[model samples]
Target: MPRLARPVPAVAAALSALALLVAGCGSNALAKQPPFPRSTIQANAADPSEKPITGSPTTGDPVDPAFAVDKLRLLDPCKLLDDDALKELGKPDDAVPGGFSRCSNFMKDKDGKDLSITVEVGQTVTSEIKKADKKIAGYRSYEQVLEGSACFVSVITQDEPGLAFTVQIGYKDGDGCVPGRKVAESVVALAKGKNASRTAAKGSVITVDPCALPSDAAVLEATDKSPRVYPYGLHNCSWVGDDAEMTLDFRGGFVPKDDKFDSKQTEIDLGGVKAYQVQTTTSFPSCTIKWVQLRGEDNDGEVVEVKSAGPKKAEFDRCAKAQSFAKALLPKLPRA
Candidate 1:
């Protein structure tokens, strides 16, 4: 999953609002926003005519069947970072789920230096594969070191022009690539043995395909044009039209509050549920509506977000469009 904006450490008002939101909420939750600096990984162009190792599913069979998008989605990311598998690296902390498709394990070396290992599955891999300079467990791999403190090692999983299983390591005291590559190797081995665990939560949004949520008619009503679907990571989907776009995101994070977005948010009722709406014209005219779908422990929970945006020159009510889109989607969500 992509990271959110940097968190403010001293938001007293935000915390106060969060307390009110979670007053009677039950446990079951979601969250994200990495503690480290953003990675500098960039994609490089690959030869268009060069055939991908994982052959086209339409013309032939995929070489790596286990890495297929469907199979990869069901595998629990936290389980992939097994303690036994990472024992050689250092003392790893309990794995924490960042989102549906990402997890992180924080560790300390014998010398007491900090290291963080994060694994993300089903990440879009396009031109990045062109830089695959090595191989891990028969899969083409790409490795890059950033400022000697962070490293990213990714293995191409499927070539429906691409998707990857990636491992990122942040080790300020030593060469991050060494541990990064080791973790990548361990993940590949675990995947080969079918040892990666799967999510067992009943009625989990993790199992639902985001692209399948909004119907064709609802999409047309929202964006005013035929939709082109784009699924981001495993939990977010977007419907793009000629002049407008709508996005639906299923995420785990702190309870939504008025001060969270740096703009005044209005509280609104959505089929008996409390929801927040915020409009921003910083880059373009857009409106966002978000509400808690399932409450988790503390102030965290699963959230459903709907956003609608259009070019500034287009004359339309963005907030009303977003509200309408959210109302249409609310009934389709599984009950907590």
Candidate 2:
């Protein structure tokens, strides 16, 4: 099983907003900022060219979340499945569905490769691109995942009122799926969003596990100089010198345009977590840190002990959250 460590990625430094929108092709929402690297114990990257590659899907943790990995199910191939499997995966198999087996499989490319993944959705969600089904808590199955051009489907069923069971099929575009991977991903993502909204309205526990969630990830971070943060989507980010606090400016996403950093005017609110932007001041530790702190229910259901080694309370608080989040999540991580 893979586990989550403390400290979220810097990309998640900001909060994902209900009003903000994520593209169906992928989950483009994260909170932490980038450019900061501290105490990071990571693994090797996924060999994009390996056959039957079995390794951690993610290589490093985002700056917003300094202590965790790419937990988001983004690019995960488990969104498409057939109708029969959807019912079996979400319900009891006391007598098993007569004719069909409960398992789902993926299609391969012409070169003869295992380039897909299949998953059954028993929940709803729209967090990350890979976890779109998770964010909404809708039922889906990823019947196949085709290398770069992955595809999947989400089905909405009502086995347990308010909770929809989804059969998902995930496959890649490179494997020859119509409409390409991006388009397929977009279709499933849209379904995930709709299901998420519905679940929220009904107040249902759409998803019961953490699949690298979006809403539950309140961010804090510093980034790596490489893979710089892209300027688009619902993101509120900045670049801070090792020890300077320059005035932050938010144009797109949620930060109001031209909003000054006044105590009342400037606030970093990400669902269950809120960072009151006090007056900007000189920064300590003259080093850029792309780190991610945690917030919301992502903080719960786990046993944790947060002992801070700090110079200031806020620093301790921020750092502590990041660390604790990772530590708490480690136990639940799946094998990459």
Candidate 3:
């Protein structure tokens, strides 16, 4: 499972409270919330193309490739949960961008209870899709409850077999799957119509595919041999070789500074941009390099991160490897 690289601040706070419930720390609060309900909806496994909705952008078209991964990278995930789409759910707060391909909307029900809805595009799905027992808005959908307070509803958007549009609902006061399924349907409907907004800024990292950033030779130099590639979501990619691994990640958040990760972090000059290098052996031998690629409003900005890791017994310096790869990769990134 791919974890969220950066969560919106408000959503993070909300999830933190829910995490306490999951940890069995809030029994008194848990008693006030309704029990998770059994789903009564039946599964529809029939081909959606067989019953195409009239005038639907994705139905009955021989080459309906609008939702392809490349196109999805350009569409804004924050726009998927617009007021018109989420009006039926509750009073929605402004949509906040979580990362390149993720956005979150926090809402309040009529009873003033909190609900969080997050939309993440281009998620890499594997065996998780096997649990998909329902189809929503002409797409295969999977619903799962998390810690009995949140629900995840993912719609398989690509037949290429790994991409999905996932909607997550955090509602501790009610059955989250019910709202989760409804939000998934709304997401599918809006996406099929091509109604989601697009990122307007030129040279934004969201337009760049992380998998295409580093050259094969560059990866080989870092990993010691031919490497296998793994793309995570739309903004992360990794190359694993026999003895080492390298990862590239693009995320949006406040600029990183020293003393942030509780490790030995040093500021280094990568070309002209100021970059931070953090080396840690908390788990294994690993080092990470990050630099702000574009400054956004306030303290938030776009960040380019590179990580290098190897076996603990390896004699090579991981920080040196991370810095070397970052220098080579930074020149290839799109500038603001």
Identify the candidate with maximal TM-score.
3
- By TM-score rank, best first, the candidates go 3, 1, 2
Residue 119 error, candidate 1, Å = 1.1
Q: What is candidate 2's lDDT per residue for 235-268, written digit by digit as tens?
A: 1112222321211111101121233223343344
**Which portions of model 3 miss their true places by more than 4 Å?**
1-64, 159-161, 256-263
lDDT values for all models: 0.65, 0.24, 0.65
What does each candidate score in C-alpha RMSD? 8.4, 18.8, 9.2
Q: How many residue pairs clash per model?
A: 5, 125, 0
- Compared to the true structure, candidate 2 yields what TM-score? 0.22
lDDT of 1 by residue, 8-121 (tens): 122234223222122212122222233211121222223446543232222223448776556777777777788976778878766666556667776676676777777877
* Cα lDDT of model 3 by residue, 1-336, tens digit: 112223312222334434522322122333222111000111112232432111111122222476766677776776677687677777776565556666666667657677777777776555445667888887787876766577778888754335678777778888978878888787777776666746546446877777778877788888988876766666778787777999888875554343253256788888787888888785468998987777666555677888999877776788888888988887788866
Off-target runs (Cα >4 Å) in candidate 2 are: 1-113, 117-193, 196-336
Model 3 clash pairs? Answer: none
Q: Quote each prediction's TM-score.
A: 0.76, 0.22, 0.78
Off by over 4 Å in 1: 1-63, 192-195, 256-263
- Model 1 Cα shift for residue 197 (angstroms): 2.7
